[model samples]
Target: MTTPEPDSQVGIVLVSHSDALARETATLAGQFAGPHARIAAAGGTDDGGCGTSPDKVAAAIEQVDQGIGVLIIPDLGGSVLTARLFERPSAVVVADVPFVEGAIAAAVLAATGAPLPAVLQAADDARTYRKL
Candidate 1:
């Protein structure tokens, strides 16, 4: 079978307690990154389980991790556990940053081929947007 060409867009996953929050966060992140960026999201279901299970997260990473890398943005503490539970290929990177600004900045940077550390640093610096 012929292999599909790798995609250059960044892949993003959002894990949150609220599905709406996750989707909204992904949408806002897309806005920040513009239309060309590739983004995928997952969230917690009504029962409090992260909408994307460990297996599912791996699959999503595989799906999006073409030539570009996949970045995971988790909502809270447990969300980190969920991401950690999955073992992904080298094309995926999980950022230990908060879900809000962290995910957004990472998505934007990933779209531009920024290194994982640089992306994480940018996400960490995103706190500037939290002004009252």
Candidate 2:
């Protein structure tokens, strides 16, 4: 197998209060993104409790950094704060979209080689998605 172009596809980070939650979310989103998009997870505290950590967030961001950008999907306010605590000079967007839907949409767009702003928009647009 061959590798995708490093800068062509944007990356995604799933931040949650549970390590299992983050990994599961990333797995679900990865289905839509295929293997082209980089999807990482940053969840739980150092002791694996209900909390977020800046170090984990930074690691997730760094893991997905491919030169294009990284879109972060935080499960809650605390997760959002942790994700923002270690912001980078590079395009590290903290999207305000719903966790699951946002990750799916963002991953799909990013896999298509969408730019940071476009991927962000895709994630943001998921807010209106409904299952009626």
Candidate 3:
């Protein structure tokens, strides 16, 4: 296995149809993961509408990538489609998991300096996470 870079955690990108939702989800993730995790929100359009933007998503991925890799958690519909456009095996992975929960789990694991695979696993594992 490749050794993780020192102080470099897997980046996380949260994509949603609403800008506020993405921003808020990132904020909530920060609250749980602390301040060091590289997380970004990509939502809505440049004109601030109720849709996802490829430009915004690309920019967010660029903003957070630190060479470790980036995990993208997309809400649904076009957001998922947009995220898929940027998927690169080693550099970026579009997670197939619940958006909010995946973001939280990914952020928490990434913050702990977990490897990209481990962080991705955490996000995937969140699919079955329960509140009860």
Q: Pick the candidate with the highest lDDT.
A: 3
Q: Report the poorest 10 consecutive residues by lDDT, candidate 3.
A: 1-10
TM-score for model 2? 0.90
What lDDT score is found at residue 62 in candidate 3? Answer: 93
Quantify how close model 2 is to the true structure by its C-alpha RMSD in Å.
2.3
Candidate 2's C-alpha runs over 4 A off are 1-7, 88-90
Q: Provide the lDDT at 12 for model 1.
A: 77
lDDT of 1 at 61: 63
lDDT of 1 at 94: 70
- The residue-by-residue lDDT of candidate 2 on 1-132, one tens digit each, is 644644567889999999999999999998877877689998899899989888888888889888888888999879988887755645887888999999999998888888899999999999999899
TM-score of 1: 0.75
- TM-scores for all candidates: the values are 0.75, 0.90, 0.94
lDDT of each: 0.68, 0.87, 0.92
* Candidate 3 lDDT tens digits, 23-53: 9999999888887878999999889999999
lDDT of 3: 0.92
What residue runs in model 3 are displaced by over 4 Å at the alpha carbon?
A: 1-6
